[model samples]
Target: MSITAQLTDSVKLPNGAELVNGFAFEGRGDAARRALFHNGHELEVYDLYEVFSGERAPAVVFPVPWTGWDRGVDSVSPDATFAVFSGQRAVRAVGSDGKQLWEYRHGCWGPELGHPHTGDEQEVCRGLEHGSCRVSDDGRLVWAHVVHGADEYDWQEYWVVLDARDGHELARLPLGSAASGSHHVSHPDGLHMGLCIGMGQDGILLHWARWDGKSLTSWDVNEGLDRILMDVHNGLEGFLTVEHDGADLRLHALDGAVLAEGEPESGDDENPAGWDHCGGFVDTETIIASTVDSEEEPDRARHWILDARTLRVRGGISYPTGPIASYARPLGDGTWLTYDTRNGTLDRWTTATP
Candidate 1:
């Protein structure tokens, strides 16, 4: 789809600047560093450090080759450094000035069925390698999922933890022997890290383990549900998980605890499958979800705001002319920002007073 932009609420930037990848980095201080991908040729890294750090601009723009697809970034060393993973290689860059420090390349996997090749051998070759990456809260360690090799015949998965200072390989744990999926998230709390496995055919598997600088404890989960939505709190004390089982949206707590579950009061389409992508946790007490009514005369998508505690719909808005690529992230300043990848633009909005 083509990238577009639209304005929803009365939230505007100082110079109407657009922010992409709302949480590109972990901490608030590093969020101001704007990373933008223009066309498929150039990747621009803008240092908004001056806007937040109150320092003079000393060479802020850095350019890197674009790989045509969305890239993921995770901060290491408590936001002093960042790990940028795209295609099959991971590069470490200094966060303060956007300087390349180190890089690592994981070899690609060849073609096979069920595992139908995507033509871009380099991208497809990783064979379920680290689709995502995360840094430890203390900034000493970095962790990611490594799909050793998963052809149509066999399935093998593992977690790779690396030393952040240098590109040193640390530990690899074989997970997904019981299940296989592509997505994973690490909730950095005390000594434990939480993992979420997104099963393409089966349901999602949730697990938790302790990270002791080198080794990892075993993983455990309470429930095995499909279409899982996950978000960990800032403190990492607990997390919010939501699942849509065709008809209703169920919300749950970490450790397999069912905190609250209910159906959408409105905006749930007859084919309620797209709820997972268009829905996420805005906060502990609030959630945002979207649905499209395709059976109608003309298909259209609508957004809904729900109360996390009551599992009730509180507000909603219909997008009759445009499509929504993602939900909004609460900015803690009474405004919300939504990234519409379809238009290649970011829109900011505000909540109405009660």
Candidate 2:
């Protein structure tokens, strides 16, 4: 029952070259404006417009270079600002329109105990595993994960919080000692943030805090869940959806009380291959997940859509030539706008209609 709509528009740059990174649509129907980020020569932004006859034109353009820039735009701030992290640099920009509002540069350090070697043997190790930059609801604070030094193999971890107004360091948290699979979740209130500290190299630890102007209160969730997805419903009621190894996917009250845990009508096995570089969220009760299949075996690849609430398989789509990147964001009209980087296309589909 899912209906899909495709919108195609190419952004023309200054040098007669066309720039495309898939259009990011905001709003609904005719009120919607598609945003394009051009990776040509340098990273530039463009505001795309549709004319009276359905022709598209570039309304504005600008530049930004924050490396290792990944998805999760909505986590940055609803006002068109984007959070980006690369190497030892973390920055947030108001798309291509505004300059870098804040930036944190980390000095180089040697490798650590549990560090994994990448690239050729002669190259210097870039210790960044995964870093995310996020903004507060009021656009007053920006949060980012900053990993430094070459000692990534050891148990030392550090992160920083920045003042979104002046780009100043507000506080720093050092996750002392060892472990793997550490994840972070920022509450929709923008005043509170959570750190899921994974211990025993296999267990998950939950720590919550309030990002007051000066300090943080240490609150811990004792449930010992493995994985957590925070503010999944766009910060509606502060409820968190959690997935654990032995337990079924459950929704917990913001206070860490289990609300509901059972197999929804759309449930399915949480496969291993799906977890790699995959992320999605629940819109109301519909859980949307986007995953890629990458096995060493030749010609084996595809993507999937699942009901996050029911955990049931809704549909499966294959990317034959592989995609450069893909992202799904919940629009207000009960539909999702997917950006497929492989073919530079934007597709809109409704979960309710599916």
Candidate 3:
């Protein structure tokens, strides 16, 4: 017996707006995700559904001061009062009225900005593509990475908690992280936030933080290992799912204890490329993964479902529409999302007993 996702829904984007992760920002409670369009001089956000359904005009449209394209929107507050934008040397909080609430400005995107990993006299800018900011589950705080002491020859990296109503730095923890850039995910617990930094060949860095009412505390789970932090399973408290060396998929506690591990099967007619990444989790117990090894489009993908708590294969999944990327997204419900970047559509799917 095997489990495979059956397509349930597909939503296309408005023209000019590419489908990017977190670009279509939506919270668990939100009725729809806000679709953003940033073309340098102007930044506009259409109610992802309002425009798609022809129910209303763009929810919010504003003129932007910057000319460079923003990588993506970091986060939209749960209350929909504000949105955060991130990119090279810029992190800004904008109000629902399309006015600047507050801004955090820094030097070039990376490197000569005194970044420990890439700072060189000649190195100029290193832009980030991730919308790395996250709002707490309670909607009281926003967690972000702000460049600290950036002017000195070597700058510091600080993960911070911000005032959601007004852009104010509340508390921060110093992480001597030397990565090219990073992305973030929220924990089920409102006060906890997780980070994954990519450093190319140097490997990945995983940082987890908890913002108590008074202060903030954080620690690294990398353990000097060469692995990439992949997904955060809020359903399983304190356990952060990760990918080691881009192959070994494992579940780890915040303290760096390995709870479960999944090894890539050798490539054959059954599993492609000797083994590939797992899809992390489906609900709290079901974890799905793909055997297709290529990051680029795979003509076909074979999925394996595993017991999230035991790291044992429970079943296999197959794609009817075609191959999906190694990453299969769990929708928190019984369903998950599958995508092909080349096709530019996010397909909602679910497991079917076959």
Candidate 4:
């Protein structure tokens, strides 16, 4: 049966704050918190905590360099001391005061890789294609997906792990995929991270990696599927993935076995409804997913609650308020976030008991 989504709490973003790739919830249990990068005149981080208890200001704020578009997909450390920007040509780390902590230069992700005649800071801001970066749970390591060389002849994309203190390349794996863009899904254990490389129509590449102190080991999980990797379980047991075409959602074990699959029933067989790439474990046994893209009208998009263990759709989540945006981000603590793109407000929601 369907459950109502009760409004619990909310926090308005700072003035002039424009979200980059929306906000993310990190940590688990009491240590859980939210992190978001807002790009306006410059990039800034808003690390928020205790939103449900009451309205809280950003616990930490870090300023980053470059425009939001040029930053590719950036991530801030859990402690909010630094932010790593996955750029068009480099993955850079910057301190709260905008000081450059470290930078790892790589091949350009720009479409016009051959047009680069001079090397300058602005040169890294010229492309629309790029990768993403994320900090480990402990904030000791930074995982990045970058093009491996500076020239066309040797250009290749790789998943690299770097020492967070300094930009020392610790371990790397050559990703044999032509990436239009990519993102990393941080495993709760801190040692393992999942990468989803989007190659457009060519299909998506899913890779799981583990860092065991000395080297980085990785393997392919989705051999021939176009799945977009989502969140990992709180216990590090398995993760979630939705197909690129929104065909279905699958729960994959740590070893890459499909435990269960769920495809919401479509009203019209001619236009089968599918889940959006956005969604995650709401808690240990439940999930919050949306089908906003399946609807032609923006307000008609809906979110659904599903059985995380079996990938079974429990029911659609009804908002006491009006319709939300296209995505529902779960915090893994039974609470999820819905953004109001119009007013820049993030509302926390919890499903009411039936």
Q: What is the C-alpha local distance difference test score of each model?
A: 0.48, 0.45, 0.60, 0.76
Off by over 4 Å in 4: 14-25, 50-57, 67-69, 111-114, 124-126, 292-296, 322-325, 341-344
Give the TM-score of each candidate: 0.65, 0.57, 0.79, 0.90
Q: Which regions of candidate 3 are displaced past 4 Å?
A: 14-65, 111-131, 150-152, 266-278, 322-327, 340-344
Clashes (candidate 1): 7
Screening candidate 3 with a backbone cut-off below 3 angstroms (N, C-alpha, C), the clashing residue pairs are: 266-274, 267-274, 279-288, 279-289
lDDT score of residue 40 within candidate 4: 62
Compared to the true structure, candidate 4 yields what TM-score? 0.90
Model 1 / residue 60 / CA error / Å:
5.8
Error of 1 at 167 (Å): 2.7
lDDT of 4: 0.76
Q: What is the lDDT ranking, best to worst?
A: 4, 3, 1, 2
Candidate maximizing lDDT? 4
Q: Compared with the true structure, what per-residue lDDT tens digits does model 4 show for residues 1-354?
A: 668998887777544123212434446544646556454645544444554455455555555565544446778788778878887767889987878999998877764545754655664445457799989988999999988665667678889999999988999998888887887888877788889888877999999999888877889987777798988866649999998888899998888999999987644766567777778898988998887472244565788999989988898887877676547777787887776768877677888866
* Residues 1-354, model 3: lDDT tens digits: 556568766655334224333234344222354555664566566664354354445666555534544453466666566777664555677776778888765444444443453533333355542325666767788777656545546567767778776758888777666556666776765667777766666677778888788877888887777665545554575453546434566778777788877765535565434334334556677776666544544554467777778767776676676555545655455566555566555566777655
Question: lDDT, candidate 3, residue 301?
Answer: 47
Given candidate 4, what's the lDDT at residue 90?
76
Separate clash counts for every candidate: 7, 22, 4, 1
Over 8-59, each residue of candidate 1 has an lDDT whose tens digit, in order, gives 4432223222342233424332134333323233333334434334433322
Question: In model 2, where is the ten-residue run with the lowest total lDDT?
Answer: 14-23
Task: Report the lDDT of model 1 for residue 106.
Answer: 41
Candidate 3: 10-residue stretch with minimal lDDT = 14-23
